[model samples]
Target: MLFAFSIAPAGTPGDSVSAAVADAVRVVRESGLPNETTSMFTTIEAETWDEGMDVIKRAVEAVQAHAPRVSLVLKADIRPGHTGQLRSKVERVEAALDEG
Candidate 1:
């Protein structure tokens, strides 16, 4: 299986969330999954939200390695009032790849 995730800066740059995300990706890769793809997204630091799902969609296609299946992940925080649309896109891609 392939594991993927996207991350937003939880707080200040010194918060260490970015480091954790990187470490998580490394651990997932070390586990010996068939394929792995990671998309790191950063929104406008001033704007709370922006429509960047298109980037995620394209990144998945671009990063897919030579493997039977592609596993997509978004490491963004989905909290109250968050739409979590990227998560849906990731799942859809995973489903489409599996159907092939």
Candidate 2:
């Protein structure tokens, strides 16, 4: 399964959210899962549903320590027997664009 998520803290003083976003990304990176962090979301691949949710849980907790309100957006692709789709998905799109 592949999970893409974006987490942020609400009602922060500053206009920039890089700090809170950094907190969330740090946790996701520390999980050691096959993951990618883009401008909008972080995509991670996990063999099991529990593994993916556990990573999200830890990430949310890390962000919550600073801000009182936290927001999370998660999208999951539950394709059994699939792996490496994280990178392959983008590569496929790029390949088609190149051909066109």
**CA RMSD per model (angstroms):** 15.5, 1.1
Residue 73 displacement (Å), model 2: 0.8
Instruction: Give the top-scoring candidate (lDDT).
Output: 2
Give the Å error, residue 90, model 1: 14
Candidate models: Cα lDDT each? 0.40, 0.91
Separately for all candidates shown, the number of backbone clashes (residues 3 or more apart, or on different chains) is: 4, 0
TM-score of each candidate structure, all chains considered together: 0.27, 0.92
Kindly list the per-residue Cα lDDT of model 1 for residues 32-57, writing each as its tens digit.
33224435632211112232343444
User: Which lDDT tens digits does candidate 2 get at residues 1-100?
Assistant: 9999998888778778888789888888889999999999999999999999999999999889878999999999999998999889889999999999
Off by over 4 Å in 1: 1-4, 14-18, 39-100
Judge candidate 1 against the unseen true structure and give its global Cα lDDT, from 0 to 1: 0.40
Model 2 clash pairs?
Answer: none
